[model samples]
Target: MKIQLLVLFLSTVISAFKITDGTLKSSKQELGFFESDSLRLNSTEENLSVSFKIKSNTKPNQIFVKLTNENGIESSFKPTTKKSGESYISKLSLPFTKLPTLFQASSKLFVSLVIASEEDKYFETVGSIENTPYLISKSTYKPTEKFQAKPEIHHIFNEAPQTVDPSIAVVFSFLSIMTFFTLIVSWGFNGALNFGNFKFDLSHFAFIALIIGYEVTFFFYYLGDSIFTTIGRVAILTGPTVWFGSRLLNYLGELRVAGQR
Candidate 1:
């Protein structure tokens, strides 16, 4: 029995706890809707862990942690701490199930701190000193109860997002290539910086405008949260073109006037 106990002790896993190296934040979620706002406990080391501690001037007799999951399930925990000042502080250890699930449909994790603010040092039932809820991560947590799937989580993000307008991409690429060539060509005729010559000035401005136009369109289309309508996209594209085109025409008129002079 002693030898077996020795072997078990040697085989036991010990977590290497360290202070946070980076800003404490939760892991990325496969589901877009859920995000974690839970105060971080420990560094994100080999083992998953998180904790929260709060200090204030007010000392309350008691402090409590309230957690809510996507299913609207709620649970409360009392933190262990010694009074530092006027406020009672609660330090906490987080469980996995109280966090948002990776593949699960639940939207977010919420946690709040409840404290007593009354002169009697008794916590009020309503509007008791409560902290804003936190969002939790389920990456390392497991719940006592099995999680059931919600249809909406799967259904809403399931449909494939529409592909970006190919024509827009082609046009953007073409404009970039043309802008490069135009700069090279314009720079050849009128040195790299030639403000006196309106033609070269227009070429420079046109290149900048064209690049901006493409970037704005791509930014909107590529963003996951934003839905870029075809009309909205087309509208954004038109701005730079009109601006660049007008500059070109103005440059020509300037050249004609200079030639006459």
Candidate 2:
């Protein structure tokens, strides 16, 4: 009787791990997507790879892969399966050049995998391992070492100016012109022609001096060598000067108008 019991226990253990029943299997845990760029020109023509696995008795009938951005633009890859007995591998070749135009710095790409026809469908996200909520880089392409640097001109000024708001521009232009004319009338050209006994004060002289200094610094900052560094230094020194000068001039003009009345 004891021998029979031992035999039964062994049989149960063996059946628990029996491969023929397809119970000892692995499910598709996750997917991986990667890219290779040959030219490395920051263009989209790189090679991409997507990998996934299945560990159940059921085989996936179809798989779909897609790349999308925050703007809802999408690119799809249709995979062809190659079977080696019970194991299957599906692959798709995608060109980066064909990616959506909306894919930009602020955009994201989603790589989703679907195992169609499975009673319990499996889904997984595959892409950059950075764990960022957004996909900022391409994963389906490899970068090549061709070393095509972006033109300096493009970085400097190639980007289109943001669409101007006509109303805002018109308002600002009118204000700037009005302020300029008011300053000229209040101070007079070189303070030589005064409308009344209102002589120019030290504050008025200081305001004019600072404004001239700011304009000179701004011009030099733009036209000088090491423009970025020069601009940084000039802005720090001149920004407050210009702000104070403008405010003082406006305040004095207001006082003059009040006195006139």
Candidate 3:
């Protein structure tokens, strides 16, 4: 009778072990509960406190708490656990700096408790706490003032482009005029201004007019006309200027030759 009882006791213990082991291996088994009230914010240590429980039958090789911010940033934390009667209580102090910096007081973070079991080759997400408020005191941010007309934005535009000083402009203009007159006087003294060989014809006047037109074109270019436009105008005048200038020079050459003879 004593030997029979001993064998039955051994069989009962073996069956219990098999059942517990099977439960640990099964992914469908419910893990445990999370105490939301157990969540704490430690400002001094700069860490967040989180607590959760796991089944007593299983001893997990690792336990992790994952936090996901609104922006999809994820952070994982490993917790130190303690063994309770029917469950293992796990708590972790995650550094606040480890969380996503964009987290605000109004922001919600998805919390997940994951466990890796020695009996199982894969990790399992057992429990989750959804829409956990970002509880850190510093998470509160000052919003912009609302419902009031904003201060009129006085745009500080850049000043308009300035030209040379009036005095300097005047001085340069006087110098240029004096240079022009000096050049004419020098030409007259050198007999270069003599119009004896000059012909009062359409070609001569046209050549002179084209030369003045070139000066006018340059003046307009300096006053902000597009370089392409100036170039186009100059090109149109080039053919006429060339023809008239060639004819005037040939006529002068003939006149000079005749005078020399």
Highest TM-score among the candidates is held by which one? Answer: 3
Cα-lDDT of candidate 2: 0.50
Arranged by TM-score with the best first, the candidates are 3, 2, 1
Ranking by lDDT: 3, 2, 1
Q: Cα RMSDs of all predictions?
A: 29.6, 25.8, 18.6
Better of 1 and 3 by TM-score: 3
Q: Would you list the clashing residue pairs of candidate 3?
A: none
- Where model 3 places Cα greater than 4 Å from the true spot, the runs are 1-165
Among the numbered candidates, top lDDT falls to 3
Q: Higher-TM-score candidate among 1 and 2? A: 2
For model 2, the superposed segments whose C-alpha errors exceed 4 Å read 1-41, 56-58, 104-106, 128-261
lDDT digits (tens) for residues 128-204 of candidate 2 = 21112233354343434686876666346577778789999999999999998888787775785655645566666
Task: Quantify all predictions' global Cα lDDT against the true fold.
Answer: 0.45, 0.50, 0.59
- lDDT by residue (1-261, candidate 1, tens digit) is 445323322432231211111122234311111123333322223121223333445455556654544444555677675554443334554444433343122343344334544432322111111112232232444555668864665345577778879999999999999999998999878766645553446555765777776787677677742554735766776777777777777766777887932
Error of 2 at 190 (Å): 39
Give the TM-score (vs. native) of candidate 2: 0.32
